[model samples]
Target: MKFTERLWQDIAPIYNSILKHGFVNELMAGSLPTFLFQYYIQQDALYLADFSRALNLLAARSIRTDDVLQFTQFAQNAILVERALHETYFSIYAIEPATQKMPACFAYTNYLLATTSLQSIAVGAAAVLPCFWIYRQVGKHIYQQALQENPYRTWIDTYAGEAFDVSVNQMLAITDRLAEQAGAAERQQMQDAFRISSQLEWYFWNDAYTQNQWQV
Candidate 1:
């Protein structure tokens, strides 16, 4: 099996939990409260801003010119395409600009930034892969099972659409190529990074569902 397939297997439990999460189920059923979805959109906007930066960091660190170009385009799409989706939601919901990153957003984005800046390019690619791969999976799951008249249909369709699939396939290919070139130790680190990010992906969704906030 390919390295990316093994990474997916390693996170099967976490992915299952994400699919079972109340936030996802409610969104699928069109029963999620507007306030919760608004909060999530706000936090997600913050996440994309930093996520693009992390991609740029990886782009800079990539040894292969093609990898560099791919990461750069990925960064551009994260900012332009995803942010456009957020903006549509913002206008529809009248969401004001978010002033702060919630705890989960802060932790997840910071982890990506730190890893991409400090780790090997292979490991950095691993760290960011979950965002692309897991979302594609969840998006497809939701699209398949979601209510036909769901309010979050746009969100679901955006992630599950062919354009999004193209980007995801690119990321998966890049990650597998990197893994093929990596030493055994580096591959282990890649797996470790992918696992931690996958865990964080669950926390991010649950955090929004619970409306978690800072104690201070």
Candidate 2:
């Protein structure tokens, strides 16, 4: 089996948990409170800013020119398209986006930035892959099971579309190519990075689910 396939299988439990997360379910069922979504959108807008920078670090460290170009564009897309989507909701919700990161939010994005800054690009690339790969999977799954009149239909459709699938496949191909030339230790780092990011993926949503606030 391909490494992506094996990787997915290894993380199936986390993947399944994500699918069953209350935030996902309520969004699909059209039952999620608008206020919760508002908080999520606010936090996500902040998260994407950091995520885009991490992509830049990944692009900078990439050995291959094509990978560099791809990751740069990935960063651009994250900044442009996804943030535009958030803007639309920001207007609707009348939310003022904040720069302050939720604890879970900072932990995940900082992990990516620090890892890419300090480690092998192979491992850094692995760290960022879960966002692209898992979101597409979650999008497709929720699109299938979601309520026809789901309040978050546009979000579901944006993620589930063929365009998103193509991007996911492209990232997977990049990851596989990296893994091909990786040392065993590097490959293990890749897996470790992927796993932690996947776990954080769960917490990212849970933070939104709870609308968690600063403890101070």
Which one wins on TM-score?
Answer: 1
Candidate 2 on 38-153: residue-level lDDT in tens? 88888888888888999999898877899899999989988998987888888877888888999889899899889889989888888988989999999998999987788788
TM-score of every prediction relative to native: 0.99, 0.97
For residues 82-150, could you state the per-residue lDDT of candidate 1 as single tens digits? 988999999999999787988899999999999999999999999999999999999999999988789
For each candidate, the alpha-carbon lDDT, in order, equals: 0.95, 0.88
57 in model 2: Cα distance from truth in Å? 0.9
Q: Which lDDT value does model 1 have at 26?
A: 96
Off by over 4 Å in 1: none
lDDT of 2 at 64: 82
